[model samples]
Every structure is written in structure tokens, then in C-alpha cells.
Target: MLGLRPPPTAAAEYTLGSPRHPDVRVRVHWPTAQRPTPAETGGLPVLIYFYGGAWTLAGIDWLGWDRLFRERAVDAGVIVIAVDYSHAPEVQFPAQPEQGWTVLEWAHGAARELGGDLDRLAIGGASSGGNLAAAVALMNRDRHQRPIRLQLLEAPALDLTLGHVDAGGVNKAIPDVILRQMAARLVTQYLGTGRGLRRHPYASPMLARSHAGLPPAVVWTAELDPLRGDGEAYVTTLTRAGVPAVGVRMIGQTHTSGGLRSVVPAAEHLHRDVVSTCVPSTHRRWTIRIRCAPRTTGYEPA
Candidate 1:
């Protein structure tokens, strides 16, 4: 369980409704520090973040990660936009993904209005959020010519079809029945009818027709998560497609560990990584060097 933390300094809220479905309501979170100003703070990169909670539970307000996102956005001199989309069982299937694209398109056009550089953009999320981010990146690459500079996926649920089997290589102590039940619930809610679930790239990004021309990516996986293999396979696909990708497996971590911001050391480390990746550099040109902390015996990259 996560402990309460002080909310981050309030940022301005912008209401954006779906153009295709005006009845559907959504909002975007913009960190206060990144507001547009003619004097300074202009031309900063934008990080559009999506939150995770399977396809049903959790919302923009459920986790305190927004505060952390704001802190990192300010510290890294980038504008952060968090989107609140409709969840499943109420809006089911392609609804959330479609809303995600709408938000992305809106953000791209309004980045300057929000004090973000249109040329430098990154998409990121955790768990289910990560899955959406990955889907968005692929969709953007295949459908449009917009530039996506980087992508960061933390414990992404890439392959919803994996069922009870551990797809990411590592396995936890959770019983198969419970895992299967949870997976079934998620799959059913996300795909609505499962009739053509396999054909939709948003439902199963791992089965995409092609992974070519995707932006450079940083894929994070937990050593104990059931979805770990999905993340691993994604990284492999990205690399094999000639895209630059980095895979990191957090030792002694689980599927929902990143959400345990208050109790997990791995969670804290993950936050640091997110900040490092999302923040824009002061120089026009940039170089990222990930220096690992010295490890003791038995600790190593998987």
C-alpha cells in the first residue's frame, strides 16, 4: 500500500473533449512551472504521461506520481502533460486508446501554447499506461510523420494475450488461478468482445505488423512481474527492427511495485530513471549516460 504524500504545487488544468465523441470528457494536467513565457521557459521538451491501472481501476488522482512527475518536469526543464482518459467497463476497448491519440494530437498542436517545444517530444507511462504509450508510439510512427524523440515504458503490459503464463521471463509466487482470473478480467474489459482482439495493435502491440522506425526507447521491467516477458520481447523487437532501445530489469521487484512509491526502493530508483529520461538537456545537442550504482555480489543486469 502507498502512504499519503503532499500534493505537488497545483498546475493549471485544461479541459479537452473528444472531437469524435464530444460527449466523452477528458482533462490534461500541465505542471505550473512550464507555463509559456516570452521572456524564458519557452522551447522546452514536452513529456506526455499516461497513468496505469489495468483498463478499469485508478484514475489521474489515484497515485501521487503526478507530484513526482511535476518535480521531474520542473527539474529537467520540460513540460509535463498528464491525460485523464475514460476507463473500461464504462468506456471499454478502443475508447481509452482513441482518447490517448486525441490528447497526443491536441498536445502536439498546443505544445507551444503550453510552453513545450514541438520538435522535442517524449511519451511515457507505467504498467497499463506503459502499454498505451507504446501503442501510441507505434501508431504515430505508422500513421503519421510527427517526430517522437523518445519513449519510456515502465513495466508495460505489452501482451495482454499472454494469459497466466509469465511472458517476461521472471515469475512471481502468485497462484496461476488468481493470475489467470485477473488477466481474463483485464483482457475482456480492454477488448470488449475478444472477437478481433488479435488484429488490433492497441490491444497487442507485440503483434504489430512492424516495429520499424520507432523512436529510441527505454523499456523497464521488474524481476518478479508477470508481464516482464512482454516488456523484454518488446525491447527485443525494437532492437531487431534497428531502433535504439535499452532494457532494464529491476531486481527483486514486482508488477505493481512502481506504484508502491512509499515503500519500494526499486520504485524510488525508477522515479530517478524517469526523471533522467524525461528531462531535456540545456545544450542544443544531448548525450545520455546511465551510470549504474556499484552492485554487490548476486546483483546484475538480467
Candidate 2:
């Protein structure tokens, strides 16, 4: 047992599990209303968000992600289905991605029961979570053709090979070489001994031969993050493939800055951007006027 205190509580939640994927646990967080129902709002959109932990650590119970998911459910007026997929090493490549696919399928199938709109279903993640989200979007396209309305990637580690990373950042306390080494180690841990798997498209979405047909994407990156290159390149490739994609960089912020929404003002923009972006573009619902902050690289859909 983890002799630790339980994490913060959400407004409402329920569990989803399957015998095939016993290790994975899916949690659906509801908005904080006394009697929340879809009748008033027509139906809420759904965001199946995956949290980041380099693909090897952390869970939905992580205080930062727990808080963020709760806020997103209320502000964005969408149901947040936070996935707790199994980590790497203990499991391996394909395992995590497959679990992600399963969760997406489940969410799509249960949308009506969850009081969610099928038209505005989206997949999102941060760092490693971003990688999984991208992979699942690809799977949804290739297999079932699920209507994934949007793909929100924040500081996503798209290229697990670490080829498209920026070595320099605002914080230089750790030398570039050490940072690279640490990142390399994390990649190794996720892939185990199967280093060739790094080149697989699902493992590294940036290396995918084609970025066409994926859902519209809102990619966010921290100016001081090494993963900035991955996020930006993803936007470039997606746009080139005739997909509508937007990339934004948070200036003066590091990789972890996004989790500081409660304390950092700039971080609040992250939440705001997510809330704004989640609004369906082609739907029959309401509209939200988006205004980008000065420090942020503006978000404009192509």
C-alpha cells in the first residue's frame, strides 16, 4: 500500500475497467453542479485527456493533473475522462498505446450515457500523454473512423527518439548534455531493449509517414522546453498535409509551468486556451471568442 494521503476530491467521478486491461483504470470527472444534467446544455462535449509523466510515471491522482482536469470540466463545459494508463518498463510500447485506444473506444461508445455529445469528442494529452493522444488519433482514423473533433497536445513528446528536441532553454542550471542524457535515459526506459521501436509511428507520431486526415489540432509548447521542436514540427507537418492545426509557445515558461495554473498567471492562459480550443468548430452549439495574451504565441486555426 502507498502509505500516503489521498489526493484532492472532484465534483463527481466514476470508474471504468475491463478484464482484458486490468492494469488500466479510467476515471470520468463530472462538473461541480448540484444536479448536473445534459438536458440544460443540450449535451456536454467530452475530452479524453492523458496526463504527462514521460510515459513511465505518474497517474491521474497526481495533484496537478487532478486539479487541472476538474477545472477543465467546469470551465470548458465538457466531460473530462482522465485516463490512467499503465506506465512503461512494467508494461512497454504498444501496451500503453493500446490501452489508450481502448479508452477512446469506450468513451466514444458511452458518450450518450455519460451525457456527452458525440460530435465534439476530443483526445488530448501533455508530454507523453500527447504522444498517446496523437497515436490514438491515428488509430481512430485508420481503424474505426471515430469522430475525434480535436487533438490538444501540450508540450507533447511526439518524437520519442529525441531527435527533434531543442537543447537550449531559459533555465540553464542543468547543462545541455545532462538534459539530453536524462531524456535519452527516459526514452530507453519506455522502449526497454527494443530500441528499433522508437521509429514506429505510434511510438513517435512525428516520424509518421503521413499526418493527413487527423483531427484539427491545438498544439502548445513552452518556449523554455526541449519538446518545443516536436510541438512546432507537428503543426508544420499537419498543416502541410492539409490538416487544420495551430501551435502556440508559452514564452518564459518551462515544461512544468503548465501545471502551475493555480499559482502562475501565465499558466492560467494554458487552461484558458484549452477551454477555448475545446469549443467545437463545426458543431451546433454556442461560441467563444478567443483572445490571445501578449506573452503567448496566438492561437489561430488554419
Q: Against the unseen true structure, what C-alpha lDDT does each candidate score?
A: 0.72, 0.81
lDDT of 2 by residue, 1-302 (tens): 21222223344454555446545677787665543566755667889999999888989888667777877887666788999988877777788888888888888888887778888788999999999999999888889998887889999998988899896765678787787899888888888867798999999998999888999888999998999999999999999999888888999898988877545667878878888877655554423335654543343335
Pairs of residues clashing in candidate 1: 167-229, 168-228, 168-229
Candidate 2 ranges with C-alpha deviation above 4 Å: 1-22, 38-41, 170-173, 285-289, 292-302
Error of 2 at 197 (Å): 0.3
Q: Using TM-score as the measure, which candidate wins?
A: 2
Task: Output the worst ten-in-a-row residue range by lDDT, candidate 1.
Answer: 291-300
Flag regions of model 1 displaced more than 4 Å. Answer: 1-7, 22-38, 163-173, 282-288, 292-302
| Per-residue lDDT over 106-218 for candidate 1, one digit per residue giving the tens place of the 0 to 100 score | 88898777666788888888888898888888778877757788888888888777632473334435566687677877778777766578457887788788889888889
Q: What TM-score fits each model? A: 0.86, 0.87
RMSD value for candidate 2: 5.5
Top model by lDDT, which number? Answer: 2
Clashes of each: 3, 0
